[model samples]
Target: MRVVAVLAVVVLAAGCSASEPPPEDPSVDFSADDRKVTAEPFLYCDVQVKDCKRDNTAQVKLEVAPGTPVLVSVPQEVAETPWSVVIQYRTAAGEQMPPETVATFPPNKSSTFEALPPGDGDQLQTVEVKQAGAKLVRDDKGEAAAVSRGVWSAQISPPAA
Candidate 1:
């Protein structure tokens, strides 16, 4: 009887904790070399809303020493949806990548590599940012459902000559 009671209590406690909502905000950040840059990884989630502003955009610009790796750091969060992290660079020659991205459909977590610009006598002017995942959708039964998502990105460049 004592064992049974203990088992019941454990189950009840586990159920209670699981019912709690996960943290809506996760700690996500970007860096240019070792210097951290301003970022809001969830910016794309704004578009998932019904009355989102189309003009909203998130951008980060930083100048770092040559050969530094632009990086994305997400210190593990309750990621339970498709999330994307993108980073693109424009070479001094005016070229860009197809936006590095990641997505998921299940509860997940992430760590990512954004970019590494050449340390030579070259510089990056701007990084085109596009992070989109996590969404609100209509179910087959005509019900509204929410999907979770997370995203991050970074770009690097040397000082303009």
Candidate 2:
């Protein structure tokens, strides 16, 4: 009888502590239908520096299903100041708006932004890396001798469906 009592206690304890996946992030609009959303292709852009030597990336063309939340992120390779973003998309009413700053980040940090889509259907998504707070130092010849460069790459996150 003692053994049975102990087993019952253990079963009750395990049942009480049952693990559950965290509720979907409130900012993200997760789909009710179990359809998987595939990741879009990498759309990258480089610094607009006139004499930029290194090839860099800044933007990516984003596409996701209606209910899938757009996960946008920028990597901080160099310790540069704040980051800003400009996103252009069609409204649910099919009106197109010019690209504008949708979000911004503070100085010298890497972060992610979660944004929801307008409504059901496809939209033209354009994400641009507006500013990374990078500066350039030049020689007397007006040539880039040294650069206070910030390397960053922007892309989608949570690749898994």
On TM-score, the leading prediction is 1
Model 1, 1-161: lDDT tens digits are 99999999999999888876644444456666457775554343444543332213444557765445556555444333334444444555655535433332233555554555543533444333333334667879989755433333344556667
lDDT of each: 0.49, 0.45
Candidate 2 residue 33 C-alpha distance from true site, Å: 12
Question: What tens digits encode model 2's per-residue C-alpha lDDT throughout 1-161?
Answer: 99999999999999989989843211111121243232221221234344333333322323354435555444343214455555556766768767666766666664556555456653535544434424556679988632323332233332336
Candidate 2: which stretches are off by over 4 Å?
1-50, 53-62, 78-80, 118-124, 134-161
Residue 142, model 1, lDDT: 89
TM-scores for all predictions: 0.46, 0.43
lDDT of 1: 0.49
Best by lDDT: 1
lDDT at position 90, candidate 1: 56
